[model samples]
Target chain A: MKISNKKQTLAFLKKHFIMQLATSYKDKPAVAVMLYAVDNNFNIYFATHKDSQKSQNLLKNPNASLSIWEHHSALIQASGVVSVVKDAKEQSKIMDRLADAATEDESFWPPVFRIKGDEYIIFKISLSWARILDLEQDTIRQKDTPFTELNFK
Target chain B: MSETKKALIILNDSDPVLGRVCKNKFKKQAGWDTILSSTYDEAIKIIVQKKPGFLITDIILKNSVKDGLDLLKFIRESDDKDIAKMPVIVFTDLGQEPDKKRAFDLGANEYLVKTELRIADVIKRIEKFIS
Candidate 1:
């Protein structure tokens, strides 16, 4: 999807809290639903159980992808390169930001989600490119709104 | 009520990133406050000042004026009762058999290879000692 404005894209990405993370290793592909927060540079951050299959796969192969969407409106597919956030101070800062984002729903934020220990790992997904599937436009306008490479701030 | 336990992580200043990560993990997962000592002298000073309940160290500390093994020996042989008896866990990339045996012989309560160490496993081991 080609959007003429980058600000509009940023708004769309920030509006969603969940993303479907897709990763593959040695011909096996896995997808997991993850809660993510986007940063100013469009980097996505998420935490996962350290021993989970997705975490293991990412550890083996950092190349991955993420998808976010709403049923009636649009879908955004973005490619990502994963890296572990190993710094304590940086992890604290990111967790605080995430907690602030989920303030409206405290139940969703807990000690488990906090980057406090080894049971979980914090991941930073550096987005390479993204494409939007404008579902409403595809249905109403009667044309495929093809995927586009995201080069926006 | 018992006082809170403190854990100290000793690493090379050149690898501050790992130090920071370990410090965070100990604090967040085990509910322990942590202090970092990057060099041999700094480590000695912090140990004297904080008297940490738990200690974690890497085998090879590049910035350390004295090696990690030396510190382990110092702690075990210290005249101070608390310092001499503190539980120590050695977390390092040195996986050679001799290195492992040496750390264990030097009175390290636990030894972990950084390449194979899992944060969860480390936390569990720490909880066992510090809890």
Candidate 2:
């Protein structure tokens, strides 16, 4: 089915806390599974060590892609520009939200919060475009394309 | 007596017309009080003392020891949670994307180009948040 509004996309984002983040630099690409938090504006926030591959890649090139999916249920794919959230207060707030999101899975805690010695930084992904596939609805099964796209730019 | 909420405006230099316009419009239109400060130091002092409902500031402050971006950083980094979380609108003549991005990265709630919008439009934008 067509995702006619932002609320549908936002609801899917809020319902899921984990995403596969893809980043690239110098023609090399890397992907990591991260616990993330979403704001009302569709900005995705996650924390990582300053020296992590993703962080280093983002510092060199801010373009990134992310995907969230559930088994036989739904999927969301998005691309955005990433930027470091340098403000201490803002970082703390985002960390709190990330921690809250992590609570859904008792066995898992966001690694940035647990790691020691190295400084951790928060990054925000401001999504420019996104597409959602809702297998549960199955409204587009007969159509040539089975995705609903939302352009934020 | 009930106290009216206050809105603070920080500008590069003293502009009597802009100050008067904001004060009159905010007070008359929304029953909110408005305070204007032209320096970073003075703005910080007012923020701590008055605890305005929201803030509107320019990017450049000619007379202040620190510029408006510095002031924005200070607010976002304030130890006081209330002050740190206060809504801030960056109203500046700088219309560049980098400036806007910097303001947002610093936690500004809104960014308005001074040349592109009238004072009335700015006030309306502020009202959308405060109301």
Best by lDDT: 2
TM-score of chain A of 1: 0.81
B56-85 in candidate 2: lDDT tens per residue?
998888777788888889989999998998
DockQ for every model comes to: 0.03, 0.01
Instruction: List TM-scores of chain B, every candidate.
Output: 0.92, 0.89
TM-score of each: 0.53, 0.51
lDDT by residue (tens digit), candidate 1, B5-124 = 888998755545355556555555556777888777888899998898878887777766678889999999999999999998988878899999999999999998866756667777
Q: A10-96 in candidate 2: lDDT tens per residue? A: 988998999999999998899999989999999999878778999999999999999999866678999999999989788767866
What i-RMS does every model get? 10.0, 20.1
| Model 2 interface CAPRI class | incorrect
lDDT over C-alpha atoms for residue B27 of model 1: 54
lDDT of 1 by residue, A1-153 (tens): 334345656787778777899999998999988777788788888777787788999999999998888876677888879999999888766765554444324234332333323355789988877887665554446554444456533
Model 1, C-alpha of A108: deviation from truth (Å) = 19
**CA lDDT of A90 in candidate 1?**
80
